[model samples]
Target: MTAPRLLVLQPSQSDPLAKLGEWLEAEGVELHLVPLKEEPAPASLDGYQGVICLGGEMGALDDLEHPWLADARRLLSSAVSQSLPTLAICLGAQLLAVATGGQVRRGPQGPEVGVLLVAKRDAAGMDPLFADLPFTPDVLQFHSDEVHVLPPSAEHLAASPKYPNQAFRVGSSAYGLQFHIETTPEIVLNWAAKDPESAACARPTDFDLDFLAEAHRDFEEVWQPFVARFAKLVRGELSPAGCLGTQLPLV
Candidate 1:
């Protein structure tokens, strides 16, 4: 059988897939990356079993600055409409929200940065992507925008005190995460160095190389398996029965 193929749309130079790409590839999924700043996004999901849109510094509505964002939003909307396995992180999540009849804007509470925890909502207990995660999962938060209102069809999956729409599912297989599960220690350090103002929202220890590395270790322990399950969903080896309050044997 052919390996499941995933189309990964990278919106900026700063937010490369890093560990998330490694984990997905390790799970035997073929990834095709399109750096949106440098390349045009494809018109549709064509040929890809799954799609992922990575975070970026740009706001979700910044089409004037990054024209490709329009195409990215269209692709995300397409993925959700088709119930294709989809994952959107941070800015990508904001885009997903807007593409699907939700809202995104500057975070009123302030920027949320650092390694943080988001509690899974009761609805997450039956979600194919979120059901098995710890009630409070460790994630890297580095965004100034928030998805305050979910799409009308979305199922709320997780929340933090500051951002209520931390994680959600737009369809049976399309998921959006308001935090990062894809960074490496070095990538986070670079982000901190580039945006000191946003970085200030985090604890001082968050930038420490050792602390960041250790946090990544903990992050992988929880999210690597999560990515594997996503890959399974893409490959048709896993079912979305959990969405209906049932479990199907893995193929």
Candidate 2:
């Protein structure tokens, strides 16, 4: 069978899907990255089976400064409306929220920037993608902005102490993750180097490469299966092993 192709929107040159790409490709999902910051948005979602928008430095509300954000919002809105399997990370999630009539602004609790645990909401047990996650899964939090309100159509999934919008599902197939599961050690190190204050506050002491590596290992262990399941959803295989043994058919 031909591999399923997914359109991956990369909004920033610096932040790309690092290890998450490996899991998807390993499962035979073809990734076609679109640099929205550098190029125009595609006319439609015609050829792709799914969409993935990665994290970036830009805010979702920065349409004036970054005009492509408007285009990204349109594409994401289309995906959610059409029920195309979609996953939006960080700023991408913020864009999806803003596109869907949800609200996004500076997180009042401040920037979440370390390995943290987010509790799965009871509603997550009913979600196809989130059902199998651990009760308190370790997730990387590194965003300054947060979603304040969700579209009425959105299903709340997970939450951290400070950020309640850690994970959510809009429609049946589209998802938004507030934290970073696709980051690699080098990526985290780069972010830490660039913004020393946030990173320092996130950790007990100074940044440690070895500890970051360990954290990445835990991240892979916890979230790679999540990505694998997402890839299966993109491929139209709702019943396969991933984080969840078999996805329940959506009603």
The lowest-lDDT stretch of 10 consecutive residues in candidate 1 is 239-248
The 0-to-1 C-alpha lDDT of every candidate, in the order given, reads: 0.91, 0.85
> What does candidate 1's lDDT look like per residue over 1-251, in tens digits?
78888999999989998998999989999999999989888877889998999999999999998889999999999998788999999998999999999999899989999999999999988777788999999999999999988998688999999989999988788889999999999999999999999999999999999999899999999999999899989988889634443456999
Report how far residue 60 has shifted in candidate 2, in Å. Answer: 0.5
lDDT of 1 at 77: 91
TM-scores vs. true structure, each candidate: 0.95, 0.92
Q: In candidate 2, which residue ranges exceed 4 Å CA deviation?
A: 239-251
Task: Show pairs that collide, candidate 2.
Answer: none
lDDT of 2 by residue, 42-127 (tens): 98999988999998888998988899998899999999878889999999899989889899989887788888899999888867
